[model samples]
Target: MAESEAILAAWDAYSDRHSDADGWPLDEVAYGWRMVQRDSETWRAFLPVRPGARQLLATAAFQLQHLSAGDIAPHWPSHLRDLNQALDRLEELRRGHAEVREARRTSGPVSQEKFIDSVAERNEEAWGYLDTWAAKGHVLLDVHAAAYKAPVRWVPTPAPTTVPARRAGRHV
Candidate 1:
């Protein structure tokens, strides 16, 4: 299996093994914010940032402890241990992947694994950061929608008619 596929499967299996009652699943906001899947309410993946301070994610880093850095980490006592472990394992896997290694070798000047000095590479990095930021709730705005359907009733606003400037003293 591809490295990415393996990573994905590993994450899915790990997440599936956890539950709310068991204090698993970690932070709902810290998981996936780039995917809505078949359920929207379950995870606000594609929604705008909601109102509230995003305690866990203001930035992204390789290390979980460094994820928030100076900022106080959110209160996720029950799941912190597991989350840290998962991040560590994921990091290890990525570091050890042949593709990742090759990508790193291909990266130029300043060093980056996936982000080479190219438009597409930069775009991918930006998207990756956006996804990470969204997951961490480090967003300035977020909007929620119900099924994202067209309006049931269409009522376009009427256009304003141009009113000619009033003539002074009955001047045509």
Candidate 2:
């Protein structure tokens, strides 16, 4: 099997083995957020210096928001507003980055240094939003665990035989 398939299989087995008293499948939700948290941390190591890091972080944030709007919302209504706010900030950051890229492309080599400086400035701003997003995610995870009496700690699964290819220019 492909590595993703193997990972999914393992995740499925793990989820099957762990559920709340009401059969709410709390472990799957908590585990998904945990993975997102791990990836967010990994992304952070290089994100403050690399504007290219925005996409991965944005994707994770959006996914988490989607989860909150769906299955997780009913249980944690209070956190939904915070998650939405974080996602809105992230979207604003993304748009700001896009404008910088567009300006750089049109202005040509004469403004290369300026472009770099702009990216650096935006990177710091991006980090603030990402940090808050991750923090909110952690809070939601904690609330989920506490409400359902689910374990917050992740149980290790066997490694996939073949790792997936990393995206070009991405740290995580």
Best prediction by lDDT: 2
In candidate 2, stretches whose alpha carbon ends up further than 4 angstroms from where it belongs are 1-75, 139-172
**Lowest summed lDDT window (length 10), candidate 1:** 139-148
Question: What is candidate 1's TM-score against the reference?
Answer: 0.20
Clashing pairs for model 1 are 48-142, 48-143, 49-141, 49-142
Model 2: worst 10 consecutive residues (lDDT sum): 1-10
Q: Please give the lDDT score for candidate 1.
A: 0.36
Candidate number with greatest TM-score: 2
Per residue, candidate 1 scores C-alpha lDDT tens digits across 14-131 of 5665436565656665444312221232213322332222322222221333223223345332233333343344344334454544655676443552443242332233334333
lDDT of each: 0.36, 0.52
Q: State in Å the error of residue 4, model 2.
A: 23
How many angstroms is residue 92 displaced in model 1 relative to the true structure, after the best TM-score fit?
0.3
Backbone N/Cα/C clashes per model: 4, 0
